[model samples]
Target: MADEKERRHQHFLVVAYGAQSHVNPARVLAHRLARLGGADDGSILATLSVAVAAYCNMFPSLDATTDGVISYVPYSDGVDDVSLPRDIADRARRRRASSESLSGIVASFADRGQPVTCIMCTMVSPPVLDVAREHNIPLAIYWIQPATLLAIAYHYFHGYNELITSHANDPEYEVCLPGLTRPLQIRNFPSFFIDVSGTERAKAFIEVFQELFEYMDLWRPKVLVNTFEELEPNVLAEMKQHLDVFTVGPMVRSPMETQIHLFTHDNIDKESYMEWLRAHPDESVVYVSFGSLVKFSKHQIDEIVGGLRQCGRPYLLVLRRDGIEDDQSHSLVENTQSQGMVVDWCDQLEVLSHSAVGCFVSHCGWNSTIESVVSGVPIIGVPLMFDQPTNIYLAEKEWEVGIKVERNSDGVLTGKELARCIELVMGEGAEAKVIRERANVLKEIVQATSDTGGSAERSLRDFVKTIQES
Candidate 1:
């Protein structure tokens, strides 16, 4: 038993693909590993490898990796200068490149004193799976999204394929999953299941998910989801039946935000936003940000701006010029800069926590979704893609803490419709009050589950124990 345990490594290697969404949560989990245990003081020797993106967030101060607080390493996917290409084949090639680089990182770590006992790789990163197999090391999945999405994906690959694919062409097609009560529409399905361009992007995404599951089955490896079981109790229990899924997340409020931002933008006025929030009345500001990736069209921005103007509330909107629809849209954002503070980006969690932030206008990305819930802010979900539609369903349908803004006949969201949705949540209506109250209740639950000795922490400890035992 002693020898077997000795063979298991003391260090952990956490490989996160470089998308801003992926890196933030991955680093937070890496910090969790260090807290769990790794070095002589009985703490963790957590080494985190972030995929280097077009805008690399790997800072200089993280170089002294041996000091025992999680060490940072960078792996390249060939698109080290600019953002990743949209071409599917190019993405595949870069993924392979990342795998090759990570292999060398593993060797270098082993040559030093510490060998990684296990690897925890984040979503859409099958390359790390290959590296684990090559080294005969165990590879565990650190699923960054909510367990609900994971379960949806599992069902998609397992038994619901024909049901989903057959109706993939139909926008209003309903899907009946065993656990979820409300039948999901084809529009409610995750992006990988529903093709957008009528092309191979969806197929490519499906292959990636398929490979992830195949690796999980082949290794029977542990899977860690970024959710607290308290919040996703049913989904967690339902997913555990199919795979060894552990809820070790709602990975928020880590100290890593100080030195690096996964996508690294410097122009935002963080202090000014906080100050603006300070000056406003409690629960009076509508905070809008679409997140790091998804870009909105001019039509969408026009409606959003028009809605905010009509709402008669103090608001903060984030609109990047690069992603704006046109000069007209950009000018609209510029015009609204004084009406409501419009910037390229701001610390989302900071903005959410402010007493002035009454409601959040979000893209409903899982990270933003969880953040809004935990922050006790009601949502106006304007989901752009991926698990967002499903998140919107959960937010508005199941959770009752959100309202989704729907598009018009021409697939454009009108200003009047957007205002009505905002009024439903942020106005003085009794229904709006109920939604805000529910959001507060959810916020308490989310906070409780991540507390010391709580569900998320305990689950993470158990995961560490399994690594030791193996």
Candidate 2:
């Protein structure tokens, strides 16, 4: 009976930071964990834990029991607000509250005969490690960004902080990191690396990462990256010498799978967007979105509008509700209706998979980058901050699947520049053809890793076996 019980079930908990980008990849990982042996195998169970605010946003009624496969559980961070606290005192309170709440949650699972076998956390949620240690459960980190970014962060905290700090102002200065084959320009590094401003947010980011890496050194948990060997072979090989790393990703969900949106959309008809796409010619429409977190300035918005209009292609733009002013919204829609459609939000994977979407104008968030790769759509990268620049570097410089828009002295990508990039990506030119073919080839490579008995599949199974034995 004990052996049967061991064979019948293993529970895995995935804790994610409460943002759309973080939560989406974490949820996808949970679903993949639940489907490990087969959907109905009953050998593995996966649960996703996020903050209460995010949970409420995804399920307005706050009635999420399970999303059919994986269970949904929310932990408290002291504040129930959508935005995280920026003040040091409030942030401390949130961490303490979350730590206590999550400890109780793990205990409750055990009380119900579902003791967690292993705990996996997304980036920036360091408290999960303490809880895992408290319960004596094995822990792993599900790195939701590219392997190159992970290498940069790991090296940044190790000993290269002072060197990079000294060259922060020199955007053109290149540095050769330990594992990467090519040197990266100072500008290509993550924004946090060069942000000399001692703002609370910036300082908080640095502190969190420092603590995460310190703990990683002490605990030595396995790091599961959301990239394949074929894409970042050298960096992956380099990272393995220092830490136990696993490549079980390109963790993108198929278009047929269900997706969770942590933000509410406007009352606009979502289906109308799909119907509109159907009306356009194949490989003719440009899709633009900058993910959920970026708040665009009005000047930037007007410039994007100008570029889309000048490009003269059928386009679909997803501008978040908070990104635009109410008075400007009406005129914004009126000015672009002839050649484009503006919606508050739509299904991103579904939109990318459509036959009409030829190119994606993106912020180069890791999720957006990987999804675009999976869908075989080339990119016009307008990277803003964080790991975005690094992602774009890989897309344009490393993968050659896209081009990054050039920003002016004032750090703004103007309408003219945006139009130029659109033309280069979508026009019938040799460069455009090369970019499109590379996108398709990378898509095939990523899809192959997720196939039956592929690299990602074998790595995931090995992880599960490690947990079961432990």
Candidate 3:
């Protein structure tokens, strides 16, 4: 009872922008703080109230415990209706409503004696940063993307498009950046920013990237990235020179690390998937998943199906409908006829860690990339957009641990190429054995990071100290 009373008196506030990547970590931190019981009025303001509410509904056990200490403030209502590609534009359009909600939440927190001390802004949500500044609080931005991607974004802001453009034409062009000695080209850079589509809306969106880079320069907030130093040593070192960086990542260590209460259905058959994998000989099953957000067209989906079919090895696929535009194409699963068990979603960590799973075919989302690395699984990289290409580049080029697939005009990966790509990773291709060995080494390092005295533990401790000191 005395402990509860003491916990009730200590407080801290975290504002997460409307994304699961941001909310998950914030939720974990909130729970960690609550378990410590330092303050009662600690508030967690989130932009994804609907998502969080849905998560709470799905996983009551985890969320219900800390509800008393953490307050979820929905900064924008109905924001999920907006398409992800146009998220910033939508936020800009509703700036007034957004600002009002944010200010109100901070003011409310103040009224309760829980002065907002630290705000963790995700991606380019400047409003959260603005509110933190208004309240005189220390703000830290978390990047789910690799540092190399951030550097590319910075390059784009500075009008250095030559490296990206040149690289796309010739993968060996070796375009140079401030910190990198080797010239990188377009084939390796993020494909999304290649050509401005000349739409007014697109042009407006382009400005946001520049605005984000400029904002970072002006604010210079300490950054805590969900990436590991070992994965992108060059990029991490360069980024650290610019601002304070702490690389304690692969945040999705497991279901427990996610901190959100997920429904059992969301993870059901996870063990079954592992059991199936174990039945196979070692390093046989290939796991395929295109991270959470990317959508694909029908032609591309057909190609992907063809490629997987060609592999002829047991495979586990996490399928989503976002990729196929046509209803028919979206039904590729029906035609594939269960050659590979196509699930909508599963516990990724369990599947990757399964003994039967040998390789990962991924969109190279940082979370997925790191998870695959930690699991000692090599990757077949098919990056889609944003930081994905950069993530793929680091996985393949920097780490020498993956194979890249070529994308067609419509950004569809054909079945033939997909099959070949899988074989290249699994077969005795060039550098295949060497890459596998390196991947195993990386896996060990990631395990150590999560263990005692590793970078992740140290970073989390530093995070706690920042809050306590503040």
Candidate 4:
């Protein structure tokens, strides 16, 4: 068995971005790749994962979670704990160390009989790609963002900078970009593109995307995006013109497979939450989460409390500390008298799968978006930053799975407005019915695309074939 394995694909390394959001998808993809090694074909691929130290500390489960499918490795990035103060200097050190550590990984793997053949790095780790190129190891990028964001990045770096920038201030102003069917409002554009001079981190993401584009220009490599073909056909088609793009995702667990989580479950009566849903009528509860980041302001938290009270719905909200000083949201959650429960975190996918979950109040993170889509839950988008706005646009404008609530003149989403949006989605109205039906339809489509021998599976097979050929 060892000799046969040695004769085949040998090894494929998946480097994770370490954050819960990034690592979760990367690990799922790695699992698929590992499983592919056992296919009837006379090929084998040993999968290994490398995560940055910072997220490693946050999610120690990665160290013990693999069930002999993939090997987990950690690379130090100056600050092992993300809670530590990090700046440009720390980032530079992390990048340099990551590259060197990868070099060591390559040598170590080569020393073993199974040599590393390909490296698939999750988004935000260009240094991993550089190491792969330097080592002459074939590599692909696993883009976790939606194809719409990819299109936005492509156009932003290509030529549409002036048009996008001009409308940055006009939150209601809409702009048409290539590949997308609907016009994107200024509010729909990613905050970084609108606020180019916004923050150091935002600027850093621009630089990263710019560098990634440059690398792609140098070598138009394959990019494995975390979306199915049906979800974003136009954007995927247009992106394919530039590089070999494959839709190898909705890289998520099936409903039959137990839900995957990187963080510890908030020690709530986990079963009781599901039981609460079972007690409620179908499509009668609300699910809310901001996806591992973004602390809600006290004002925002208060508004949420108000909305839940006004809507008078059974709701589950994931309220984490998120390493911020602001305790108003947490405190208010503790004290608020709403007919709902708040967990620091919960089995989000499982909660979404519950028949009682009527609509999702989401931050529009890609993972949450896809999960909601798969679960057939309609959404109410409250996007904050990064790729969220674009996701909300897709949800509200493109897919019709959700609506984005309007902020007041003070730019606050008051309780009344929040209640209004929730009612709009969850109420027994024509629009709400339409959204639910569309969400259900999309859910079937997503499941079909993710089923065995489906779009996502075929894409993975093709990716494996590419590695074999290489």
Candidate 5:
């Protein structure tokens, strides 16, 4: 039996979208799969596949291929540019190119005598499903969003589409989604659902998800969500009735674990930010970051700086180089030098785990949300789009560890509102204390789940066993 198992080595291929948010979780999942080994000792292997542009960004020096565990493979998405597509035509080209390129990658793998046993893909493209089917490889969707979002998307397509679409413009309108305990406001839903912009780009975005859900219904592949059972038991349970759902995450990098950055951390002294963080007292600094993709308007930047200054606490603000103009960036840096340190980017998990950092002012991206929960840092959510609004909903309402800052009628979060939320989260009041305590408790739960033999680990192991047996 051992010899038989050893002879049938299993190779897993993970394909991810080129964006930083998508790539990070996919990378973490690939590493976890590699660590699990195979049915027989030393017989398992995992490879990470991303778009060529993103691959280049991650390995800027073009120095190494394998990250010592999982091997790296790049698939052409038609465009070799790092920036995401701005129009529908480019998106279509990417999908077609990705399909052809990825199919070739699989064929080449077989030629090399290491055919993939399973393929896992994040929301990259529908072509991934076709590729897995053509190769007869078991495939799983690596859902890097909250399971709540999955449940919502499921219900939205299942039977609630009309109800949601009719009330799309009504932000305050509430609907009790199946399996969700409370009624969610239209505003709390994913931005994709409410986008009535009528632009081809927005329509294309909607069409992609629509097709994805349609595939889920048709193929019924396993969904490996990046959320723990404890964090979203209800939604997970609901999903299991129709889909093979696995709670295998909080797939966040630990403070000690090295992270792969898909974006360049340039024009900033990384050490200087860490040194400044060390200088502050415990729970005294506010850390502000909006992940890699969200480009804020100049007014929004000024509002954020105003809020941070008014909060009267030391802050470490990450303003990405591409997100702001040079002149504006320099002016904001000089203005906030007395009260905070502004950098292009820094090691987020390190900052979150630091003693001096108390609250995170975030755009509530799912990756950032899970990181905050793992690090025991509370959030002041200022969600923009995609799944961010849903993630914030989970944080503020479901988890009770954060608060959402309200934007004005013009859809702008003013400095006053930002400052108010910051104080509410970081103040010495009882509500703030409760939020802090809840965050710590949830952090412990997340850690336990990710530990050896915990629910997440067990789920991942089960997934490996299932794929190997198949």
Candidate 6:
């Protein structure tokens, strides 16, 4: 039993950044750590919730009793005025205002005599890096996105001879990366990267990617991606050649063939919505959602609505109408009234896992992209910002899992184009089946890698051991 006692002494300070997307994975890892060896074993698990309190809500999933392995520490938003883009300048002020709130986290860990030995942090949160440096802890930087995208980001920052210089305007131009099987277009990069040519936004975007790449060198955190080796062998292989790479995800549980229905919702009594989905019998239903955070202007939103109306196939859309003003705004709803369900948020995992969902219209965030692929749901990539466009390119071109959408100069997505894309994804001649079958194979590999003796589980166990020693 002395051995058990020794094991229980292993502790970690799992640090997380803002948003549910970033926090969820860390929580999953924490749960895995807490359950080490067995259910009754109480391993010393503690957390320093850094950067933003947005993650505080996810603490319940990690520790139901609220006493296990958790503490919230507010951090100074290190972004200065010089770093702010026109669109995000206000956000900088907010971060600066709350910078001091993170001081308590440092105090708590110091008081406990647990000088955090290892820091696990999501990418983009500078505060975690700051604290990890201050404490001299070996940090594990979680990418929370695909390795392919990270490679692209790295390549972009390194100025790799214009990966898509002339082809930026050509949709048909196949982009050939060092490890990818096929070429992708510059448009396949996230929308922000594609459109921001010489604008202030472009410079800011460059800065963010530069920061990410610099973090890669100076910090040298063990790189963690939300993918398995089988799905992205070429990209993963290329990445490992450069860094201390580790894979611990696709992060969600693998539903077996019989259990695929485990995540599907039958109680979605939005009968009207389901009825619309049923109207397109034998035809695949395209699922369009932009996730929770991104917002579209009224014109952009209406254009999307019109496009769906024109696409003429059945669609399930989750549209958050927040901040969209118009007493007459119901006019937008009335336009595409027949073909879609525009909810604020849907059970995305459950919806993706459903048998009926054929294609996803996504922002290409890692979590959503991984979930879509794992569920064998093809996608229509419409990236907003950050790693999303990179993810979209990988999904549509490299992974052969889906297609892409085009946006106009005014940033308006036309209804006719939307309709055409939807039809191409779900129509009779569509490669929807091929996409689904390929995705299933990817899912199988991820499940195998995340199981009891799989790479992710083992790597996580090793990490836990390191935490214990620290």
Judging by TM-score against the true structure, name the best candidate: 2
TM-score of each: 0.92, 0.97, 0.82, 0.92, 0.95, 0.78
Candidate 1 residue 462 Cα shift, in angstroms, is 0.5
lDDT of 3 by residue, 227-315 (tens): 77776778778877776677757565454444343323343566666666777888888899886666677766767777888889878
**Model 1 weakest 10-residue run by lDDT:** 255-264
lDDT of 6 by residue, 1-470 (tens): 97676546655566665565776566566555655656555455556464433433333233333434344443545542223335556555544443344435555665876445466777665555555665566777777777777677666656653655545566566666676666656656655445548777766556655666687787667777777777778888888887777777777643321111111223453445555555665336778878656767777777777787777656777765553554356456744555576655555676676666778888888878888877777788887776787787778766778888887777667777777777777666647666666777776776677678888888767656654554
lDDT (Cα) of model 5? 0.86
What is the clash tally of candidate 2?
A: 0
- Please estimate how well model 1 matches the true structure, expressed as its whole-model Cα lDDT: 0.79
- Per-residue alpha-carbon lDDT of model 2 for 1-470, expressed as tens digits? 88797776889899998888998889888988898857776789999999888888888888877988899999988887787677998888888889898998899999998888898899767678778878898998899999998999999999999999899999999999987879999999999989998899988999999988998899888889999999999999999998889898888887888777876554255578899999999999999999987887777788888899888898999987776645465466644666999887888999999999999999999999999998999999999899999999999989999999998988888999988999999999999999999999998887788887899989988888877876
A best-first ranking of the candidates according to their lDDT comes to 2, 5, 1, 4, 3, 6
For 279-314, candidate 4 gives per-residue lDDT tens digits of 888898888887887766677777877788888888
Model 1 bad stretches (over 4 Å): 1-9, 38-42, 58-68, 82-92, 196-198, 254-259, 263-268, 335-338
lDDT of 1 at 235: 76
Instruction: Give me the runs in candidate 4 sitting further than 4 Å from their true place.
Output: 1-7, 39-43, 46-65, 83-87, 256-262, 266-268, 323-325, 335-338
Pairs of residues clashing in candidate 2: none
User: For residues 1-470, what per-residue lDDT tens digits would candidate 1 score against the true structure?
Assistant: 76755554468899876666777787778877887754445435788887654124456454444434678777887667556457888877887888899898889888986787788788867788889988988778888888878888888878888888888889898887866766889988887787745666666788789988877767688999988866667777888888888788788764225434644356347777777789989998889888877667887788888888887777899887766757467787675645598877677877887888999988898888988888999999887788899898888888889999988888777888877888889888998999999999998987788777888888888888887777
lDDT over C-alpha atoms for residue 42 of model 3 = 33
Where does model 6 exceed 4 Å of error?
1-8, 44-103, 110-115, 157-177, 182-184, 190-205, 208-212, 253-284, 310-313, 323-327, 334-339, 408-411, 465-470
Off by over 4 Å in 5: 1-8, 38-40, 83-90, 266-268
Clashes of each: 7, 0, 17, 0, 0, 10
Could you report the Cα RMSD, in angstroms, for every candidate shown?
Answer: 2.8, 1.6, 4.5, 2.6, 2.1, 5.6
Judging by lDDT against the true structure, name the best candidate.
2
Q: How accurate is candidate 2 locally (lDDT)?
A: 0.88
| Residue 91 C-alpha lDDT in model 6 | 50
**lDDT head-to-head 1 vs 5, winner:** 5
